[model samples]
Target: MPVLEIETIRGVQLMTMNRPKSLNSLNEELSSALIRAFHMASEDDEVRVVVLNGAGKGFCSGLDLTTVDSIGEQSSRFQALDEYGWVGRLALAISECDKPVIAAMNGIAAGAGLSLALAADMRYMAASARVTTGYIRRALSPDAGMSYFLPRLVGPNRAAKWLFTGQDIAAFEAEQAGLVDEVYADGEFMPHVLRIAYDIADQAPLALTYTKRLLHASFDTDLRSQLRQEFTSIKACFATEDVAEGMQAFSEKRKPIYRGR
Candidate 1:
């Protein structure tokens, strides 16, 4: 069976990590498949927004430890680097994708799986779902961009506590810490997430893309540089047909029909 499943509803592309037997653990196949899926969504104009979730009981259980033995057998250092690089690429693809990526966490997300959830622009978690930084428990450090993303999301102090303890963070506490945007009852999670995704998809696509880019860049760029970028992006947006449609709709007292031009 396929390790990942892709589905589209309206303009939102939903990518499901499909390894229920293992709680969607990241193996070589699933990692590569996710990289491809995110890249495809980045380039696909039809995809206005992307929602990532997992099948079965958990969102993702982190790395498949069984594969670690074989990975260590690589004769050359470069081979080892290349193999490990795929995990970074998967995280990068999600963060850099033009369309806003939302993580809909259905259950437990631990170790690198938590990193994956943090990579998304927004996260909506199920009430029963939980997340943990499990590296310390295994006598390992964090990977899959966990150190970078976690600190930024929850601040250095909270991140340190979580990383050092490897404690499970329930959905309510996660929301309070600002790690997740919203928490819904398990039964209502998908429906609410889809509704939000569709709402975002209905907006001007170019505007959404530029806004996403600006938000991500804000962390690294100075205020002056970010303002310049925002100025340039908005000027470009004005040239698109969607802007005219939006103005027209306002005048007509009707919803704008954006073509994403």
Candidate 2:
């Protein structure tokens, strides 16, 4: 079976990590497939939003440590990995994706799996789901951008606490702790995620993509630099035919049909 399954719903590109027997753990094949999928989604004009999830009872269980040899055999080219060399590449792919990426985690997201979810623009969790650092238990430091994304998502103190403990955090607890955005019943999880994805996909494409870039930049850029970029972005959006359509729709009291011109 393919390591990754991809389907487009409306303008949202859905990527599912496929390895149910291991809770969709990240093998080399799955990692490479996900990296390529993110890059492809970014370049595909038909794709407006990206949604990531795993198939089966749980989400990724980190590095697939139960594989033939300590999570996976060391291929000659993969020897450079101390902690998921390819997973690092995977993280970069998601970071560079031009469209908004959402993680619709329907089950437990442990270790690097949590890191993957944390990297998304938004995260929605299943009520029965749980999350944890999943590193300290194995006497290892965090990997797959966990340290970076965790601190940014839930603040440094909370990030440190979770990393040090490696305890499983329930979905509602994660939401209360600001780790996850929202929690829904497992049966209803994907539907809720898709509903939001479609709503976002229905908006003007260029405006949405640029808005995502601006918001991501806001975390790193200075106020003056961010303001300037926002101004530049707004000007660019104004130049698009969608802008005129948006204004006309506003006046006409109807929804705008954006062709992404």
Candidate 3:
């Protein structure tokens, strides 16, 4: 069986991390599988959104420490590629995908795993979930885009504190820090997350894709450029059938029946 399992429900690509025995820790096979899955999702026009989650006790426990131990510490180029290549690819997969990505944090997420969760467009955590920057405690600089993501989301001071101390923050605290969008009780977590994913999948496909792309670009684009880009997108939206349906529905005083044109 594959280390990663993928299922599609209501146009949402559900990617599940399957190594429960390891708390779904990252390893070579899992990383490569995830990269492939993301690429597949990106190419499949039928997939409107993605929902990510882990099975069992945790989302992920970070890198497989034993795997790194087996490789032994080395400064060789091959070692660097072995450790960082897939991580970079995974980051790219998340950043470049037009479809919205939502992470459902069922339990603990640490180090590189935490960075992966942060890459998602939105994150929903179970009340029992916890997240931590685990690199500093293990004498490592942040990788897997943790350095890049942390400061942007939580500000430099909070990111610095987390990176420097490497402490875990519970789900409620993570929500307060803006690292998590919402915290649901374990009993309600999966259903709530699925509902959100279904909601995104129900939107106009082209509009949602363009909106996700524009939002990603807004981070790097200047205000003037973003406005110009948005102007183009807004005009394009008016040409779409879904937008036509929205207008007609409003005039009819009824809920819009968006066909995801």
Residue 170 lDDT (model 3)? 94
lDDT of 1 by residue, 1-261 (tens): 899999987899999999999999998799999999999998898999999999999999998888777645666777666744667888998899899999999999999899999999999999999999999999989989999999999999999999999999999999999999999999999999999999999999999999999999999999999999999999999999999999999999999989999
lDDT of 2 by residue, 117-216 (tens): 9878899999999988989998988878898889888899999999999998999999998888899998899999999999999999999889999988
When summed lDDT is taken over every stretch of 10 residues in candidate 3, the lowest stretch is 68-77
Q: Which stretches of candidate 1 lie over 4 Å from their true place?
A: 73-84
Candidate 1 vs 2: which has more TM-score:
1
User: Candidate 1, which ten residues in sequence have the lowest lDDT sum?
Assistant: 78-87
- Model 3, residue 229: distance off in Å is 0.8
Hey, what RMSD does candidate 3 come out at?
A: 2.6
Instruction: Let me know the TM-score candidate 1 reaches against the reference structure.
Output: 0.96
Model 2 weakest 10-residue run by lDDT: 66-75
Candidate 3 per-residue C-alpha lDDT over 105-210 given as tens digits, one digit per residue, 9 for 90 to 100: 9999999899888888999999999999999998988878898888989999999999999998999999999998999999999999999888888778889888
- Cα TM-score of candidate 3: 0.92
User: Model 2 compared with the native: what TM-score?
Assistant: 0.94
